[model samples]
Target: MSITAQLRDSVRLPGGDALVNGFAFESRGDGPRRALLESGHELEVHDLVEVFAGERAPTAVFPLPWPGWGRGVHSVSPDGSFAVFSGQRAVRAVSVGGETLWEYRHGCWGPEIGHAHTGDEQEVCRGLEHGSCRVSDDGRLVWAHVVVEPEDQDWQECWVVLDARDGRELARLPLDSAASGSHHLSHPDGIHMGLCIGMGQDGILLHWARWDGAKLTSWDLNETMDRILTDVHTGLPGFLTVEHYGADLRLHALDGAVLAEEAPEPADDEDPPCWDYGCGFVDADTVIASTVESDEDPDRARHWLLDARTLEIRGAVAYPTGPVDSCVRPLGDGTWLTYDDTSETLNRWIEAAS
Candidate 1:
């Protein structure tokens, strides 16, 4: 499908070097809501009250002086009234109008480099070297993966499931023998899995495990790393990885049996890997995958379209404004609600007929 840029708006931020971290399209409000990371490592909330006429201004700029520096919000409540923020050594909630509702911090042996500020002092968790955290859908469970030193100062992977209401550890999962490092993906459907990817003994071994409400179902794929890389997609039944051998790359459906695979023209070069975080289900057979394109060496940048079920090449377009994070969602009148973070604008686009 050919996607053309329809509308674009550039808003002047208060501080220099302002990077947008999180954004939400408010349904009830007049315009969209955006959160930006300022130069001082602070977060600012800008409420675009009027969007139709192109006039935009922040309704309120909430300065979150957590601790080390401000990263941004990971999740926002459905109503847009509450948000969960993670930065440095602090993770807490803030009101929509700029008020610190609650915050949690830790004090451990470390420099005050990447710590979040609570109220007066900074805090860091014990052995949590450099990692991130995320809250569950209901905002009741908090999950974080950290790198810690155990017996010989080697980095071991560990997870902590905590009560969101009081910040108490409820469950812990440590994988010292199963896998080394950590990589995971989770959804609201109770699907949680972790992967350790690297050049291993069995020539790129892919170890994966799923949380099935009661027990964890684990599997392994001993193939060339490129094949696993090319077959990666989130829309399918399990952890899908594209395997690229010399002549072709087959999309492995991971836990699910192979649904479809692609082997494009040999001379055209491999069609690139699937990298979109969210996949828009176009139909039972097709999906709309977001891509970030570039002007110089467009193929090198992370951008392209693919068949949802088959992972085949379906034409690619490079936006004029270079590479940007974008999402395409079905909106009713044959148009999709699209947002571009690099341009700091939101607009609509229609998909071309197949």
Candidate 2:
């Protein structure tokens, strides 16, 4: 029988799009997630628990650097004391009081690195490429995927771990990638981080790294295939990834081992149903996967509940209230999140009682 999904709670987004990491840090793994997003050069932070419980009226907001290209991706510290933004030319950390704590400037992510450098917050760049950054679970280090100034007419990108307090460069690893965009997945140990870089039609690049105080050791996983790392399990020994073309979902060990994998079969009169890039472990034993992209008709889009460790299909997820959207963010703690565009609300979900 198909598993039923029920709404647990929801909060309407204040404005703009909200980025949620419900299970980001190990310390606050069980609590509701805190959310932050850029809205016209302003960073809005939401205590999701308070908003959902009707305990707080207004969430926190802070001023941020002006972005000529785009806001790019950003992450807040575990304690919500500050935030770091991977910008067009720099990685900046801003305090909760709207103060610029520190900024690390790098080669321009704009079209031409040789462009005039304004050295101002209002400086504009002309490029669509972006890299991502995330605060470590311990809140002491910030791991960033950034592009460096090129040499010999060749582009160079690197992953750098910086001091979260002083913005000092602690460690850096060069990456051979032309990323359109990328994101970081934090390991529970707080010392390891997984980076997935999207290289447009060139394919995806997956890199795993460990920072042990003095050095940064990195490894390239699946050197040939394009897999997008989506989520990590708190209780399991592996992380989740979907093929770049959504061909299958895989559970990968940190040492570059495939623990398990699942792919869908083609139905009658239909092309093979490929998985969407969005998927994750809802619990140690259960995973939530989607195939929204495989369906041409939105009404028939689907999500499934599978055995997390074995890649066996338990059943397709059933919603009593309505059909959920295609994208899912699994918290890996028996819960996941979805958003309703019409209502502008972020909805949390769990298995329904029989």
What's the distance in Å from true for residue 310, model 2? 0.7
How many clashes (backbone N, Cα, C below 3 Å) per candidate? 15, 0
Give the Å error, residue 108, model 2: 1.1
Query: Would you estimate the TM-scores of all the predictions?
Result: 0.55, 0.92
RMSD of each: 7.8, 2.7
Off by over 4 Å in 1: 1-73, 79-81, 93-129, 147-155, 175-285, 288-295, 298-303, 318-348
Where is the poorest 10-residue window by lDDT in model 1? 21-30
Model 1, range 249-347, lDDT digits (tens) per residue?
344445535565544222245454343333333333344444332123434443334566676867553455554454454221233344545454555
Error of model 1, residue 176, in angstroms: 5.8
Model 2: clashing residue pairs?
A: none
